[model samples]
Target chain A: MSFPPLLEDLIRSLKVLPGVGAKSAQRMAFSLLEGDRLGGQKLAKTLAKAVDGIQHCTSCRNYTQSELCDICANPRRELNGEICVVATPSDVAAIEQTGHFQGRYFVLMGLLSPLDGIGPDELGLDRLANLMATTEVKELILATNPTVEGEATAHYIAEIAQQHNVRVSRIAQGVPVGGELEMVDGKTLGHAFSGRKTL
Target chain B: MSFPPLLEDLIRSLKVLPGVGAKSAQRMAFSLLEGDRLGGQKLAKTLAKAVDGIQHCTSCRNYTQSELCDICANPRRELNGEICVVATPSDVAAIEQTGHFQGRYFVLMGLLSPLDGIGPDELGLDRLANLMATTEVKELILATNPTVEGEATAHYIAEIAQQHNVRVSRIAQGVPVGGELEMVDGKTLGHAFSGRKTL
Candidate 1:
């Protein structure tokens, strides 16, 4: 619709956020115009600040602002001969939330979907191998998600790690905790069945 | 959970989004990590640029990089003495999308909610009155939402507009275009009943 150009631009700007559809964008525009000018300003300011402030760690590919992201800079991170190879930074955060794993990470950037034009280079597999060759890494934790592409990428990375003489392991895939058997999707149940372990 | 301090900070940084809870933040963090470090960088860059580049229009209070937003700069908006007042910029967009109105707008910046400690001053109502006084504004369209606070704010503004010899009218409320009468909530029905037309 033809609005005074100012109003139209607000809706277009709100649409830039991820998962923000047209209706949600409209809501944000309304909120900003109505009285949440501060909120809108804050959001806009943060958006700019976060973009410029947060950068990928030169080593791990995690979000950071300075030369290295916070994780890469920490002394307590068990840089010990262990690195968790993951497909995304979000995966790293998920693993960290579990408060378990004590090591570093290598973000894959993408999977080796040759059909989709993504190759080993796009996934940064070469970079991971280079790091393994240079570092005294004893183990490589394969933490790629359980999707088809994720699994394929994990296997490919594992093979490379083996060639580099670094121990490789994959995160488990089975019935999730608190999972209802009846509600469990067939694919997940099938995966649970195939990956069954002896306790 | 003992995570690398940097990793922990990265997770903490993502929690500022509107609907993002801890779990969602964790998921986003993990996804970013698992994906390309470059992609994370790209997302960060985009966020920063949007925040820094956007500002609000001086006149309409809609987002803009300059003093006047696009609509306020336009020559053809609301020339016949109508000024639509809304709580948010999004409401302006909604009306524009319908392409129904032919007038300029004054975004209230927000509604006056006593419970929330919001009042007329916060909404810049005085500025609106000034605009009405100087401009050839005859009709003040109270296009605020139909919520209790929105309704109250409309009536309050209407009272002020009356003092200035301007006609004040409210947008209609009822079952939305795609809404089923059965599915329509009590509040909608009540507003419809109260604002029912005589045919």
Candidate 2:
């Protein structure tokens, strides 16, 4: 009535992924088994190697196999004395793609959610503080999302930067580029009004 | 600027799954790396095992780790002397879920697509023919999807079944249960009219 034991196990294990449910898992299992066995085997080998080998970058808390991530390891990035602090590695990638920021990054890996037991220590704030105090870091840009927890995390990090005498600034919040002002949410429009700047 | 090598590799490899794109793959990779490393490792191990171990059932071509699939190996299912020919194992699962049919299954794994070079041999029609000719199968129920290729494949298989003196029947094509008459397509309405029977 059901799939073979191993196939069933694979489907169940696949559900551990974010956003994947029973139907998607079944489709994935069947697609791999019926059409692309080589891709399935390659995925298995790569997944095992990545899970076993990948670790956090010692300096920024970003994912990396080596002790330091690519940006943190770069001496030129250190010379800029600017560190953009974000909540996750995907945020770091987003900023990097803009090709504008020449500084390093500090990845918090998560926001400060006390209810979920995530706090300053969990976000690796102590390591960020150590870097700010020890390095010639002059500016800290808070690029966390514009959620309540993200704002709280940024405020917490700003206090740490103040103690280290490093200037701190939060990324601007406004109507997004190419977006209609009428389509913008009330909260975002409120932020746009309050954070208005002169030309 | 980019993710670490191992993380990037994992993201790329995760794209092998159907419906997964760059963003989804990235999300899956980060999700596993950030919070579910144990699950990721378990998935890797199970995926490898399923890829290596799962093979076609000798009798019905359904996926199985042993010589015969559970349904084909059962004597009760064989006693009906009916074989339901379907395009994929998922179809078998769907029929089994209904609990109405007590016959064995013949999985084609794919439809006959001459342009894609999928002929009778590719669909393992030879083995199906052998089973029909040698076994006590009294009827063959073609349960392929209601598509052009499915119709072609059903007709092809019906010819083979006729050669072996087995009664062949196609699953009905009509307005689905609970569907509105007006909403039904013209072709289905036509079929529904032609195939109508006394209540």
Candidate 3:
């Protein structure tokens, strides 16, 4: 005996969310149905609007309702001639929070994974190349994650930057500020030691 | 600097799901926006339908699109004249999965928490009482959680059962079938000792 059809559908549909499984989906469905019908309605409306309206930014491949994302549309952000290339839009949000980088961004949206059929074309490397070649961008910062695919994606984009005669650099990988040295992973500790700076 | 307006709205909306915080919401939003727009649209449609269509079963208080839930609508389930009272619809599902009890259910939807303003009316105890007074229900099984509020609710419902001259029984509280004696909590162990029966 399963749940009523509508409740079961809600639970099954909720599993579309990342990291949500059968149990979590059922809990979410029950919670919404039991108490937060208004919140559930609002979420449904917002999700529908977002799914229908949001599109990739024409220039940077980031999600946006408009043709260009807010960051790409801003003229002042382009003054530095520096373009940061990252794997996803959330990466852009993270960098923006730092308030240090004053340049534009190029969101790859994904990395190169041959086994999964994700390659340069899937990452929109051609768009990133065109942006670099057409614009007077002075530097390209590779800020993908520390994963193997991220490194490969960064290297592939570095080659594109080299072809465009744009100076390319990678973000520093080291021990995080609040992270204890002993708790740091071997690869990160290795990077920290190799990339040590003089005081 | 934040995410695009639509993306931000989606993230905020996703936080309505239980256990989803800002970070998890952001990840869910990105996952949907990045690759699962079809899934997102389906979820939105299903969620909207569920929020608008799903309502309580008039008899059992379980979620259903129609007037009566499947179990309550079936004639065979009422043969034994046994009705199990539970705190939530999920509890009904749990009892149904066991297949041991061939009876109908009364869903309280919540425990009796006076501090939270949840009392008899909130749990629809009057409806339960009406059912008991009118129907041929011979026994009412209390299957609420083992928490304090659950016990209080069970006792409260037991009083109603007594008033209606219906037999009342509380599910046994003891160490689980596979639970280690040392790992069992003191309260459960004490109940296990007091409620011990001949093998």
Q: Sort by TM-score, best first: what order?
A: 3, 2, 1
**Which sections of candidate 1 miss by over 4 Å?**
A1-16, A23-80, A94-104, A131-137, A164-166, A175-199, B1-17, B21-79, B96-100, B127-137, B161-165, B172-199
Docking class of 3: medium
Candidate 2 regions with alpha-carbon error over 4 angstroms: A174-199, B178-183
Write out the backbone clash pairs for model 3: none
Sort the predicted structures by lDDT, highest score first: 2, 3, 1
The top-ranked prediction according to DockQ is 3
DockQ score for candidate 2: 0.75
Model 2: per-residue lDDT, tens digit, A51-86?
999999999988888888888899999999999999
Which candidate tops TM-score?
3
Going through the candidates in order, their DockQ values are 0.17, 0.75, 0.77
The residue-by-residue lDDT of candidate 3 on B1-199, one tens digit each, is 4677878888888999999999999989988987799999999999999999999999999999999999999999988799999998888888889989999999999999999999999999999999998899989999999999999999999999999999999999999999899999999999999999999
- Residue B177 in candidate 2, Cα distance off native in Å: 3.9
lDDT (Cα atoms) of all candidates against the true structure: 0.71, 0.93, 0.92
TM-score: model 1 vs. ground truth: 0.67
Candidate 1 lDDT, tens digit per residue, A1-199? 5344444555665454446577765565544444344444444444444444655677876666677666666656645667898876667767889878777888876677889899998776777888888878889998887888998988888899889989999988878999799998898899899999889
Query: Which has the better lDDT: candidate 1, or candidate 2?
Result: 2
